[model samples]
Target chain A: MRKMEFAEAIESALKHAMTNDPDIFLMGEDVHTLRINLLAQFGKERVISTSISESAFLGAGVTAAMAGLRPIIEIMLIDFIGVAIDALLNHASKILTFSGGKWNVPLVVRTSCGGGYGDGGQHEQSLWGWLAHIPGLHVVVPSNPSDAGQLLLSAIESDHPVIYLEHKLLADYWLDYMGTGGRENVSFDVPEKGAIGEVPEKWESLPIGKANILREGDDITLISLGVSVHRCLEAANILSEDEISVEVLDLRWVSPLDKEAIITSVSKTKRVIVVDEDYMRFGLSGEIAAILAEENISPIQFGRVCTEHTIPFNRHLEDNVLPNVNRILALARKFKS
Target chain B: MTLMREKTILELYEAMYTSRYLEKIVTQLWEKGNIYGEMHLGIGEEAIIAGVLSHLIPGDAISTDHRSTPPFVMRGVDIESLLLEFLGHPKGLCSGLGGHMHLFCKELLLTSSGIVGSSGPSAVGFALATKYQKTKNIAVAFFGEGSMNQGMLLESLNLASSLNLPVLFICKDNNWAITTRSNEVTGGVLLDRVRGFGIEAREVDGSDCMAVWQAVETAIPRLRKRNPAPYFIQASCTHNEGHFLGDPLLRFHRSPKKELGAVTGPLTKSVLHYKGGRLDKRISSVSNVLALIAKARAQLSFSNDPIRRLEKTQTHLKDQFAQIKLKVEKKINSISERVLNLVQEEASL
Candidate 1:
């Protein structure tokens, strides 16, 4: 077992993914070790950087997808994704259906999200929800280092446009989520593909469209994703003794939603709750209820945990809205028996 | 030079004529209360689009302003979708959210945006990708003369020049940024401004669609240079119609200098010739298409459930929107009480 921080795990997984697939390349801000190391390990042709042109490169990534190359487009900050919405929404998200599925965008957009280090307004927003609403797009929010590595590899390998959300807070966080570096990666002079066995007895394919039940309970089904999922897990543990066994579902992939898991869980639990790190109105929770109703699941109790439009900072305040054990516990207590 | 084959020239003229017809129809639609929002028309400026897009090869990327329909139509945008878009139907190109300003054809990479100069840096981004990937695909950014002053446009020039990226910057110099003339926005010509940034720049008569096309086509070769900056083409033309149908024509008629009208007048002659149907059934053919679009638009407006049909087209889109919206907003749900406290307790961004 090797110790790996989120960034290093990402490095390890990226190195392996590139070695396995000759088409994966990196494009975004910053190019020292992350790109150079990949180029030296893979080849100059496989790793690269851009000149702060998010929209163009994202569009280029879409273009490359048409040529059968998988591209990893990076946004220096999650807030910067706004600059390339045209590429993401207009081009990448609709290329498949727009071309009637003749062109599949094998694209990966990696971005760092959340508030930290007093960066102020524009730099500190967690706008993953903005990306989630786009159709023909897949989204992943890796909670820790190991998951970051594995998910990044999977995203780069996948045939759809995937927005891999990495929390700014996890840049230093560590975990062991990798598998054996496949034979193709042996030439890349790198560490193993950082999969240190899936979390205890859990399976790790973590399909891009499935929602996993992190905690099983009889009272309420608490839905969440990314960093909030972990917070909900903590809340479930805290509220365990209120005779409220809150069922926690980690909606790992936001698009191509796993409605089956959500609907089935809500049917059994009856008390439905959602913790979204995006806006409330016209966001995921509302859409999930709308979907549940269409699926003939009537009387699904609805609740959401989301952020307001105000720029987030001051850890204490952000902690309140970004979903911590306290809020989830409170919601669990209020909604569950 | 406006030299071209007879058929090609006629096609170009026809496209421009169609744009003129479209502009008139849009104005009539707005006046008739069929259109929902404000729309910019390229009534007198059809040549800029018809000219530049005529020479665009496959895989050439281009960006446009709200007043950029003629070029897209010339470049093969589905007529059905184009009219539906103007009518604000779900069948419209952008599912109707884009309205008039947001028309985009992903396949052709023709984008229309309301945000001025925003596509500048984005054009640079595409050029960077193609250069890195070794693709021959070239991107074009079409903006108004006023956009020449936008910071991003300047930044894009530097970025493309520095990176030696392949991009064509086409300025549809309609001589007026609304009421103000081009001279007022920049000290010298827009082409000079682009060249000052070390980009290859040229000026063309925008009304001559064939000339505009030739200029851009010629510029593409220079963009292939190792140290190529973005090639800038200035299409000097006129906006025969007002900014939007809601805008008063009399205000513009009396606002600009009288000399401007004689030089940049509306295509009244073209429409006048059309009234005499026998002069050119070719003009009559365009009207026939317009009549069809008008009928489709009327049905689209009367239909209460077109959006429902659009939603059905993307059946999973709503749910998918919700799921991602949930992920994006999860923190907000947790933070509402905190935000309320902050407003009450701190009131800071």
Candidate 2:
């Protein structure tokens, strides 16, 4: 099987969905940068370029979904999604309940998130936690090219609005900066060179709210999503040198969280460390810790490794703020189980 | 404009009268505290609703704002269901989850939102679907001049025009955003601002039903043709009452009756002198006297309420308008009783 880049896999998945469903259409600013030229390939009617009006286009997507079309609206960056917060939070999330189930908004919003380059404040934040906090929305953060492809397929098929977040740093070009440049055990390779793994030849759809157990162990369960999942995997490898068997869990679906898998892992390991790129306060890390605490899992030792309260634009400052393998390993060592 | 039939003109009049009567009933019910929460009523803007909607077909979609009673009434939405919803009955629209502001009738392809400027983008979506499905249906978005400055509405204008969708953006200019005059808040000519997007934009006197009717009727053909584009209609009407039912009127130094009469005198005269069709005998009789006493009274007293004008106009038709109002009143009463039972049942639950 040949490896595929994360962005390429996303484009392939959208193309497959568009080929299969005549009702599917795409709208956003500069989707071509994401390697999507469905306007050229599938006709301009299927792939639409919208003005930088996030609220209107997002509302248009919700309306299109209500009118019986599956629309994929893209926000260039998750940070800019705040402009459409009213549409996303108030309209898309509540239309079904407010209408008494008269409407089903099968709209998918795809956008890039997380900071690696020094893109300053507006482009660097990973607010998937805030998105997950909103009920009635399916928040999916795919860590690898394969899951990115499959999860997008599932999101398009979902009966509700799905916010699909792709990490800007996880693309093939940025793998050079991720530790040691495609070297096994040292470098975190991207989709190329079989780092994230090969996408299936035929498009496959995954379940909306399931977690993947990357490495099974009993000492500690490391839970994370998106790019942090790779960091956890790297951390698990590092902890293996110390004879600390770490179980790495990739939470693909941040919302409708895979609580069963988390409980099963937390119960088996009896110690857990949740690693998240989002801000620690009022975010996914807290949610995970609260979930474990509420479940009353006996002899449990819980900790979290998340981004600092604020992220700065400076590259060194961003490195300190964002979670890394060293941070995950340090948290794991600090957990006194 | 093609000559509208005598029956069609009377039907339009009946629709306008129905909207006015419904708002008065809403005020009565609201004052008595039967309807919970706030209600935005278009007391003197009935002509805009009756005129534009007179051309609507079943498949066409319309999105409206909080001031949406007139459109729903024109669409023949169930009075019992609407009243029950306003009273928060479990059997109401949305099963009592959404109040009157969130009323949506799927069967009628009508959805009303409480948020201002929201209907513009939603109607664009509806129009996008119609164009994609290759249907003759068009989508109409009804909002006030107050919401015309909203970013989303302007964005929707650009989106609709760029996509060449079959959407009609109707801005019912009541000249007030609550107590603020629209001109004081809105800058430049609205028609020119909309035409900046290279889309067709026009204005009409909302007091004249025939003008509104003619404008919408003319736009329909262009919207249905090949490579159809979005159309904009700015119907200038009068805000006869305060923003909400409970809004203070003393601040404006005017009573509701005076404000209503200031607008209704010219509107009633226009409807009476309308030369499109054969008038009802009573309406013709009013036109004869309308010229002599048009300016004699600036305020309508309780006995000379504009709502009673419909009764006078329809006397030749066996008091049909009066009978319809009675039917609505009975239906409202029955719905209120059902709502009371629902409230008790829910409380027990």
Question: Each candidate's DockQ score against the native complex?
Answer: 0.01, 0.01
lDDT of 2 by residue, B1-349 (tens): 6887767767877787767766777766666655543567876677778888899887899999877788988898987667666665566665544566677899989998756688999999999999989999999999988677668889899999999999999998866554334564467999999999978999997767767888998898888888998999998766554456544332123444654455355345433542312345434433333321332222122232334443454467546655666776676667656666766686689
Q: Residues A1-337, candidate 2, lDDT per residue (tens digit)?
A: 6578786688778877887888898887534222223443454456565444577788889999999999999886798787689888998999999999988899999888886544444456899999989989989998888998999999999989999988876755333221122222322223232235688989889987999999999899999888888888888888889989999899999898999999999999999998898989998989988888898887788888888755543344556678887778787888743
Worst 10 residues of 2 chain A by lDDT: A175-184
Docking class of 1: incorrect
Give the per-residue Cα lDDT of candidate 1 at B168: 84
Can you write out model 1's per-residue Cα lDDT over B301-342, one digit (the tens) per residue?
312221222234445456643454454345333333343343
lDDT of 2: 0.74
Per prediction, the TM-score for chain B is: 0.68, 0.77
Off by over 4 Å in 1: A1-3, A33-36, A173-206, B1-151, B155-349
What is candidate 1's CA lDDT for residue B85?
A: 62
* Residue lDDT tens for model 1, A20-137: 6667777654332233334334433454544445677778888987798888887766776765788888888888898887878888888877642222334456666667787778
Assess the local accuracy of residue A57 in candidate 1 as a C-alpha lDDT between 0 and 100.
Answer: 72
CA lDDT of each candidate? 0.62, 0.74
